[model samples]
Target chain A: MFVIYCPYCEEHREEEEFHASGQAHLARPLDPDNCTDKEWGDFLYFRKNPRGLHQELWQHTAGCRKFFNITRDTVSYKILETYKVGESPKVNLEDASHG
Target chain B: MDTVNVSNQYATNSVTERAEFGDSNTPVIASALEHANMKSLAVKTATGLGVTLVELPVTGMLVLRARDDKPALAAALKSSLQLDLPNVLASNVVVDNGKSYCARWIAPDEWLLSCPLQDAFEIEQNIRTAAGASSIAIVNVSGGFTTIMLSGNNANDVLKKSVTYDVHPSHFTVGKVVNTVFSKAQVTMRCLDTNHYEFIVRRSFADYVWLWLQVASAEYGISIEIE
Candidate 1:
């Protein structure tokens, strides 16, 4: 099992205590009334199933019960970094692939 | 606009009546494990017992939540409770006038404060008044959970076999508290001493935890103590 770091708890906890919410950083449309159906549908239902580096939202369900972000390599099953809710990840797809 | 008499309604409503005084008709408050029948399993003598398990009597618990006004809340708690807000994964306890008060850090924005059962409502009100104008939430959760003390020589061994988190003394030092999984149920565990540990488990899961402890500590010779 993965030892996931909980940013809020400031400690590494077992993966059994956490739950992976879908993709991270999904912004709602500001002008929903004026937007097209495709945009609204995409916002509601669409999610990226990226093969490489991905940012995902996760909750420490049994521990702190707080949400945070984890940047991980989908293929290698490695977590590159974990950050709090409002913070941004330092690692991106391009930096990881080249380095 | 019509004005409602809230106090009159509350006074006349038997369902919302408060039990301020005890009498022959007033029912005694029982803990969650009161009917678990653990006394039958206790050893008549404590000579060979390796682990001692005791269910603490009813305690007053409050969940304190504050996001942006944490400093204000901390000051308020310091003034009213004479205890500082604990840091991450840590707990603080204070005894004043023979009354013990403890606060365990549950999350970045939440902490659990436990005191004597009879003082819970007064403490909640005191904190609210002291933290006036500060954004905070104090919820009385005394009846929602119970504390279990696991101690003796092989107490750590029983914990190692049950919880998923590392319970080694080197990692789980004194004052450190963790909310982790214990035999499929969630428990907030705290290390009191070398071999002493305290668990706060939900009332609904108290029976399950007690049964699990009995089975896990069977090989080590478990004994129950009534408080």
Candidate 2:
């Protein structure tokens, strides 16, 4: 079982306590009323299923009940880091391939 | 013969007639384990029991939520409850005027405060008045949850088998609390002392947890304590 670390709780908890929400850092259109249908549809329905390093939003459902971002390697299923919302991830796709 | 008479009396009262709509002055209150038959289960074991489980009497509980202005919130709590907001994953307990008050950090912006049941309403009003104009939420959740004390020689073993979270003394020291799953049920677990733990569980799940505890502590002899 994966022991995921919750940034808010500042401790590693069992994976059963967490739930993956989706891809993180999705920006809503500034002017939704004037935005094209494609933009709105993309924001609502689309999600990236990246193979390598990916950034995803996760909620510590059983712990603090707070949502945070997790940078993980999808292929290796290894969590690189976990950070709170509105914070930038330290590990990028390029950084994963080299190290 | 006594059981038959009791069943007959219960059958005589229709479902609607059995309901008591008491006035505010004499409002009736019942604990979540009212029907658990805990009193009958309070056993006096001959051998040393490994786990002792007790359902603490109903107490007042409040959920305080504030996104920002923590200092203002802390000040209000201090003024009203004579308690301090605990740090993350920590809990603080204090006794004021013979009434014990506890504040447990539930999240970054949420904390659970509990006190004597009789003083809940007054405490809520005091905190609200103290936090006038501040963006904070104080909800009276006393009836929504219940506290269970699990302690004994093998309490840690029972916890380790029930929850996925680490319950080792080194990792879960005294005063530390965590919201985690216990046998598919959600519970807020707090370490009171060595091999002593408290669980704040939802009222609806009280029966489930009570039964689960019995089964989990079966191998290690379980005893019930009535409050």
Give the chain B TM-score for each candidate.
0.88, 0.86
lDDT of 2 by residue, B1-227 (tens): 11111121112334324446422322234888999777767855433589999999888898998888787789999998778999999999999778899999999999999998767777777777787777888887888899999999999999999999888899999999999999999999999999999999999999999899889988899888888
Cα error, residue A89 of model 2, in Å, equals 1.0
Runs of candidate 2 with Cα error greater than 4 angstroms are B1-27, B43-48
lDDT of 1 at B171: 97
How does model 1 score by TM-score? 0.91
Each prediction's DockQ against the real complex? 0.91, 0.88
**lDDT tens string, model 2, A5-95?**
8999999999999999989999999999999999999999998898888899999998899999999888999999999998888887786
Q: What do the candidate models score in CA lDDT, each in turn?
A: 0.87, 0.86
